[model samples]
Target chain A: MANARVIVITSGKGGVGKTTTTANIGMALAALDQRVALVDADIGLRNLDLALGLENRIVYDIVDVVEGRAEVRKALIKDKRNQNLAFLPAAQTRDKSAVSPEQMIKVLDDIKAEGYNFILIDCPAGIEQGFKNATAGADEAIVVTNPEMSSVRDADRIIGLLESQDLRGAKLIVNRIRMKMVEQGEMLGVEDVQEILGTGVLLLGVVPDDETIITSTNSGEPASMSDTSRAGQAYRNIARRLLGEDVPFLQLAEEKQGGIFAKIKKLFGG
Target chain B: MLADLIERIFGKPEKTGSVAKDRLRVVLASDRSKIPPEVMDKIRIELIQVLSKYLELDDTALNVSMERDEDSIALVVNTPVHRVREVKVS
Candidate 1:
């Protein structure tokens, strides 16, 4: 029916790519001509604007709209690249309680009226009130976490929180993965994450660890806009999966040599 | 089934996978219960006190264990039986 779907992307712990994931996904959606809005729910540590390259234009924010200091449309900053994408920045001065959960719901509903395919909430780190405020209005949740121990631990807690809500569906998107490390038995693979979470991941995409991401991020350009970037490809895959497409995971390494495992199987055939 | 599940859940953790799953599971248990292992020990002792009034039991008989089931914990008391005695009633 073209009604907007609200997805709060969160990991209970910090620095696991919540804002970056939200930005890339918003960019991907907008590229598909889907009207998308990314709401930065991280009030205190707000950086979605910097990541999206709209930091200087933030004259109004979510707190402004919530507290009646500004109109919702006034605070909405259209993306420099896509007319279909807009960002509602979090207020830097005020804290999380500056806006209540009900206020967030009202904002989402107002934005939906202007016609959008999706509304993404860039939830702050931790299981605190900010997280609560971010999630309270969403129909579904996309739990973002790294394959690392601390990230997964926080993800588990976030998963439990999602289960407590009206969960349209909760999907897992693992970020900053190196497939070579996974193949070499140096890193955590997708299987390990799924088992501990004890659920089916609706969408699984691996953003490879590339220096390009940090460089582009620092320069205020999303990696998703660059076709050659590996991290962009991963986010693109996730966007396709979100739209209900079946795409295989990225094979980052050249493993076509039919290695020792294949030889062992052939030898057992006798 | 067990082997398939083992491979599925643990996912052949080279290093990161194992650490991630282990850390997540441990944290999740506490998150759901809102009670750490430290507090659970005290709760176990209190539970044993009530059980002692009904019957004479050893430590083995009074084992108190908990399992995480989604959002709640399933608590069980495993009681060992050495003798079944009936007191005389006039």
Candidate 2:
């Protein structure tokens, strides 16, 4: 009966940017005046803390909370940048099997009762025990994938599994889209991915491939905090959409020739 | 530079996105069915064994694959029957 909406950010293939998405989305939500908690469910391969620059502050983790070694409040790490944001680090020494789905549910239930507005779980790659544990108590899901065949294939598999789990159908986030490549027809476009992924899921948002994301991650400052970053702005729009706001998607690329008339035509055609 | 700019303004580049789209369409269809590529090979072998008794068929001519559409998975099996065995006179 808790009011918190628990959402899991997942991708079946590794290195498809699940951790980065979780960190950015959590930071963006927290910036919007919501109490946000990011749970790193990768267990042994925990890196969400590093993305958030909270690696040094982790004395206790999710495993410790589940095992009763430390209280939940003691294990939660406060974000230096945002007072509303908190992070629950994962145990780097233990494997995914150490945490069960039931344990994950219990932990989420406890976090929900603490008055968090949103809980974003960073699920590990692969459709294994780690994935099951991370998604055990999620009310909705956000499936992340790149603009390549391998990532999209894995994402389709993950979507199939998520639908069968009886939770709300997943929202799709096509990440790392290079507009140049997409225009050149070298990479899959957003519409192409949506067609192959089917109409069962809604398109949450599209994030362009931006270098600012890498720079921000390296500096432990989320791009969403920067007004100049294109990827950061995309994430902000997504956050607004999640809050039920009618925000227009950002125009990342511009046409150089026939600009005004072409813009009108494209807008009407779309 | 002028030619390149003109091409940018008007030329239609070779559509490589369609390549990714086509490849993903087939691969994801097969993947979501939970049947591995190796399992399809196994099915081909078993199917040949069962069909070889009734007709003389070319072993290399058989194909077993999952055809995927927007929402359904269809198991397609194609094999050419070269010659059927004639029944003996009673």
Candidate 3:
């Protein structure tokens, strides 16, 4: 517990895959034998529970833990698939004003006392009271962004705010990247995004835009648990990197072109 | 198929990626400095007024802008000074 890490996953723009990143990375870290807790800090608009397919198991939410209505252990829902993974859902009935930044830190401290190796908070979109609450207890931060113009600009804003809070060295995760578009010079590449975001933020991982992610999310199973999903593999690599393992970035463009032969072989059941 | 073939042979006319990067560079420089265009104009006018008392400055050719590097953002001001005014002894 002394070395436990509390990280907040956030994006200034909505629908940039902040919740998905938190769910996949949490599951992947659990798969790597680390005790992980996924906390949904999006109070009014909760989705982390649904993403992890544990929505039905939520008897109490984070608000309950903060208000002393329920203990931290009572509010946490253990993932059915992974014993080491647990989730704390946000209260849907309440809004962002329901919890303050100080209360958020108290809740996280209680969760930390449970002996989790990693606590990942899924921060709500925007830079409001919700964002402050999500980041109040975090020692580190991860900024998720798409390669599009608007997303990149919002990410730059979030990075500035994080530095102002003394949360330096926040990692960057460029998600939903279309390699084909990047190859055609239609979409921004990883290097372009890094240059725009400046040198303060480090690259954590790059997740390709994969269709399997849609199917996996629909069924409450994150793509990170799938053996064939490229996005899933990327999430796994991110987990390894978090554990201090040196792993190479995935060669997404080459694999996409060379996968023709592999596709043909799969059709023949080879 | 034909379009793909043509693109492969001649390449795209313009890369939107570079355009987006260029636009973001200008936008973020202003966004991080929290200075809008009107504020920049005000700062320029104030600089010209203060400097004109001590020296003759070419206000029309004066320029004020923000330059961003890897770790810091700088307010870069470029002004043309014609001559310095001598102060009378009181």
Candidate 4:
């Protein structure tokens, strides 16, 4: 088996759906038969476990593993839904300072020996010590952002930080996009955000703003696990793309009009 | 929807997206260059003050900013000097 590739999901700003993206992507990847491990690197503000609905199953966290109080295997919580998936929750009582980058590296190195295909680290918001610790052991980075100014700006900063770390190029996942708003000129379109952030950075995927995400989080099941939600399909597409599959982008926006309207639009050179 | 499509195809000339693009370009350029806003403002003021000693110029017409391309960042300063005045040296 190949060594697990550590990837960190990060956004410089909070509440931009980093945790949600991490959970769904991990779950989706696991569903693809890849042995995946999701690490909650938020430290004191732990939430990835909650997003995974494994909050109640945590016995030992990362801090305990780093402190040598618990073995790495003991600290890892296997997902009930997927036999190949696992989680390493962060300590809730301790802060980011409790864990060192070297410790994280050691823990991840141990996890790699267990023959995982992917390791997804859920980084905390902001470019602080927590972010530093999260990205320390990661080999690649995925930046989650909203189709807005503040989120895009912060994502730019995060990308710069990732570049400085000498890690692989950071790919973007634009979340919570409202196509109607873009069509109405009320919000930035995907192309607009891409233009501002620079096209040199690759785009991994886009997730539309779906009401099912809220319901999924409330129920402790990732939206991607659902069979009928568009957001879930989007995440699944992202997972497939990550696995080197050429999946076409989903057409989330409805068609503008019918046969006559389409003909008119074409005639207008639209 | 047809109207919207036609407008988009021909273009309504909506400046919202373009405005954001322009603003983000300026902001990201400065951010990537690691130049603080206050420092940039100070540099602009000092450049104008020093240049005015020799040339009659329009301060409002002056523009000091940075631009970026694929490879490098450029410092562009534009001072609209009306005319060059003759001076006698001892």
Candidate 5:
């Protein structure tokens, strides 16, 4: 509530790691002893609960609280990993239009008063009404995107809309980037994506497609706990960086293959 | 990075269908630039609105499009003037 940063985790297109980033980043921030609340603003096509592995624990949702059926504090679902981490689940039965931008603003304001260092919103995809409502209270946003064309394009559209709302410092979080695809010219690299979007936005982080993220999503634990997963470390580093700590960029995936001799050595060692 | 490593070891593109890749390229360019298709309509409407205010012009005969390069957006306006000399050139 003191000096919290309200950030919306959004993507112009669906399936672009918005929810995963929200879950992991919220968990990472909480793990760092920062009070964090992740709001599920996806409404109808909500997956934040499932991604955070709290789908089963959701008895009351944001819609219930907004509709006065439940209190805002009562709808808050505490995470298993960190008690400081709380989640506001979206209504599965209700559509995005069921809640207005004003309701979302009120809920966020209430949570801010509860003493959170960072409030993350897992926003739904597309530049539709859902996107508009989710970003209403967002002080800033992290546009989650992949290096792929559609993701980048959608990210650009979202960036434009965010700018229209007068939200400054909207950062980019490049997710599931395959560095090999960039090397061989099959996919656009970081520079290409950045150039196309133009400058002035900070690169919050680049997340690799580490299998542990998928596994963690499946098991209901965030990928931040996976020591072997490159993405887990990346999310933790992002959390530290968000806290104003100077963490160096990590290699999510090797850009080059191992030397033939090393490959042969690995084969022998195996 | 894994894709490139696999391609290097395999020594070829992963699959066929560069056309599918082209579709991605085109769509991204259009969508990411935040250039809506509705802008073309607005251009036509504005042109007709302005032209009608001055000389009588056929609205259906005009063509509005964008000439895009690696940089800059150029709004192209093409219209046939029946009497060029009679019309006031702006």
Candidate 6:
């Protein structure tokens, strides 16, 4: 807990897979033998619990812990699958105003005292009070974005805001990329997003769009637990990178095109 | 319909990815500077008024835009000057 790294996973735009990224990365970090505590800071719109398949296990929420109704440990729900992973769900009946920045800092401090090596806060969308509360106690940030114009623009805005708050060196994670679309020039590539966002934000990892992610979410199982899922492998790599391991990005283009290209070439008799 | 046919024959129109990049470049310049188009116009008009007191300017050719680079953003102004106004000593 003394050297625990408090990182907030955020994006300025909604529906860019912030909660999914948080759940998967937390699971991956736990798999790597790190003590991980995932805090859902979305307040009323609580989904990290469901994503981690721990929604039914949460008895006390963050509001209860902050309001003195329950202790921090009592509010935290340990992942049934992974002993190293724990989660604190947000209050479903409250809004963003239910918790203040100071209270969030205190809550994180409490979680840190529980001896977690990594405390990942799943930040809510928008540049509002929820965002502030999520980032208040964070030492670093992971900005998840989609390779789309609107998402990239919002990410730029978030980077600027984070810099103004003196929270510099926030890493980027471009999620839900369709490699074929990037190769065909129909979607924005990672380089275009990096160029538009500037170089201050470093690249953390890129998760490809995988249909298994949806199925895993629906089943309350994180995709990171799947060995065959491309998105899952990407999240696992991101976790290793967080642990100071140098893991190269997955060769997504080749993996996505190899089979199809071979078939096309054979059909052309080349 | 002719243009559409030509585009179809040409194997598709311009890639929208490049178009998005171009649009983002322009929009981000203004977004980063915190200056909207109306504010930019106001700044241009005020600049013209201040410069007119000392120099004769060609307003038609004047240009003002926020230019962005990898490190910084600059309010680039290209104001063509017609002539310098002579100052009279009392």
Task: Return the interface RMSD of the candidates, in order shown, one decimal each.
Answer: 2.4, 1.1, 0.7, 1.8, 4.6, 0.7
How far off is residue A203 in model 5, in Å? 1.0
Which residues of candidate 1, in runs, are more than 4 Å off?
A: A254-270, B1-74, B78-90
Candidate 3 residues lying further than 4 Å off, grouped into runs, are A253-270, B1-12, B35-90
Off by over 4 Å in 2: A255-270, B1-14, B34-90
lDDT of 6 by residue, A1-270 (tens): 467899999999999999999999999999999999999999999999989989789899999999999999999998879999999999999999999999999999899899999999999999999999989999999999999988988999999888877889999999999988887788888898999888889999999999989999999989999998889999999999998999998889555478788889999995
Candidate 4 CAPRI category: acceptable
TM-score of each: 0.77, 0.80, 0.81, 0.80, 0.78, 0.82
Model 4, position A17: C-alpha lDDT score: 96
Which is the leading candidate under DockQ? Answer: 3
What does the lDDT read for residue A235 in candidate 2?
Answer: 87
DockQ of every predicted complex: 0.40, 0.61, 0.68, 0.31, 0.14, 0.57
Model 3's lDDT to the true fold? 0.92
How accurate locally is residue A176 in candidate 4, as Cα lDDT from 0 to 100?
95
Candidate 6, residues B1-90, lDDT tens digits: the string is 998898888877768788888788777876878877898888898999888888899876779987777757888999889899996747
Residues A1-270, candidate 5, lDDT per residue (tens digit)?
356899999988998889999999998999999999999998987788887888889889999989899887888988876799999999889898988999889988888888888999988888888988999998988988887766877787788889999876688888887776665666666666676677747888888877888889999888997777789999999999998998877753554244555688888994
lDDT minimum window of 10 residues, candidate 4 chain B: B13-22
Model number with the top TM-score = 6
Model 3 docking category: medium
CAPRI tier of model 1: acceptable
- Model 2 C-alpha lDDT per residue in residues A120-141, reported as the tens digit of each score: 9999999988889999999999
- Candidate 2 residue-wise lDDT, B12-66, digit = tens: 5557789778777777666667676788889999999987877799989998887
Model 5 pairs whose backbones collide: A1-A115, A1-A116, A178-B1, A179-B1, A180-B1
Q: Write the per-residue lDDT of candidate 4 for residues B1-90, one digit (tens) a residue.
A: 999999989988765756676677777776878777899999999998888877889988889888777657988998888986565556
- Fnat per candidate, as a fraction, reads 0.72, 1.00, 0.84, 0.36, 0.08, 0.64
- The reply for model 4, stretches above 4 Å from the true place, is A255-270, B1-17, B35-90
